[model samples]
Target: MGGSPAHLDSPMVDGYGKLQTNGLRFHKRLTKNPCLLDCAQTKEYMLHVFRDCWRARTIWERLVDQDKWVGFSQGSSENWFLRNLEADFNSQGVTRWRLLFGVTVWQLLRRRIDRCFNTEVFGRDPVGVILDYVLEVELAFLNNKNLGRDST
Candidate 1:
């Protein structure tokens, strides 16, 4: 995860896909269902969590334009992460698509883990939560710009 942007999304030692497979593993949480939403009886694997999950799709919908949704959502999962990370825009013309994408993935996984541990907050909105995290990180990065931080 240190040298590659794609490595930042391996779902290893992280509450991303395999770890949040409806509690089938990762210490086996409260439920062993197919999905945290409990609406799909399918295994919550990496691709599912990244692109197919209903909740994840919702987050993508809010971020991606309808015209580009198909391209952004479909295809081999291997190219999915890399293409998105290399993208220069995030539908809204935001040049920081990579940052937004990374933060959103992290927040999605974080929310999944949180739901597994805290059922009381199951109604949480992932899109809003993820964007908030993205905004915070973006702001911090912007603040550090021209401040000798990127000189490394």
Candidate 2:
């Protein structure tokens, strides 16, 4: 059941795989580490890349703890977002804020991969990028909602 296209093509799964592959390849080439070049994929590595990576941890902590936008369970990105959407909807944040959170998290993951893989320097701060993305998305959502209100 979890192997369906809905699961396979999820942004979280795709993003995680892409980031993990890019990160592994970049580190191997940069450091000339043969061990990394042959490293097998694992769930632990994917979790580390998505959640515990030094760059990404701060954003996860802030969103889950400070903002209360997410829960505490460690799971795939798709599961996490789906669970959070339900919780947020039940909590009455469903209209716009929930969508903003979901989209921002997805964007943050992609941005992290882009910054890491596309830059001349290898190390990029995922947490900082996540924060910036969250703010940008939130502002856009608010602006759009306000425009709708004014038009109505």
Candidate 3:
């Protein structure tokens, strides 16, 4: 139940926080910018990208179903993220969930960047691209954490 919010160090989360508050240097706001996401459900917005985007929702769904962590699917504000970080769960579970949250945000932003600059990396199914990134992040996290723990 006690862990630092170190997972929030992700650059994507920082940029997304800025995006939500009109602090980023985007050429246009969500109201004016073209929604370049594969979902293309609507104009791009912070809440939409993190909480309501169809593709984002899909990722959350998979996390909930597979990891049994339902908290990721909740809340819509920047404050919601802070609350999630402060949520009461067992220490190891809390760390894992926080890491998952950060990884999810990072992958979401990476997907958008890939669409903008490296369309071929996205291939046809963008959801698949996201799933692959999530798997890689989770595996890397497990390896890193295991390396840090003493076997004795």
Best by TM-score: 1
For model 3 the TM-score comes to: 0.53
After superposing candidate 3, which stretches have Cα over 4 Å from the reference? 1-17, 20-33, 39-42, 65-72, 88-95, 123-152
User: How do the residues 31-115 of candidate 3 rate in per-residue lDDT, one tens digit apiece?
Assistant: 2345444664545567676667776776666554444355545666777678656653222333355656666677776665555
Candidate structures ordered by lDDT, highest first: 1, 3, 2
Question: What is candidate 1's lDDT per residue for 20-111, written digit by digit as tens?
Answer: 36646434544555444644544567767777888788888888877877778877778888898876436655458887788778777776
Give model 1 RMSD, 1 decimal: 5.6
TM-score of each model, in listed order: 0.71, 0.47, 0.53
Compared with the true structure, what per-residue lDDT tens digits does model 2 show for residues 16-107? 44434444554456423323222243323544545555544555555554445345445686676566667542222334556545654575
- Could you tell me which 10 consecutive residues in candidate 1 have the lowest summed lDDT? 11-20
Error of 1 at 54 (Å): 0.7
Query: Pairs clashing in candidate 3?
Result: none
Q: What local lDDT does model 2 show for residue 12?
A: 31
State the displacement of the C-alpha of residue 78, model 1, in Å, after optimal TM-score superposition: 1.7
lDDT of 2 at 78: 67
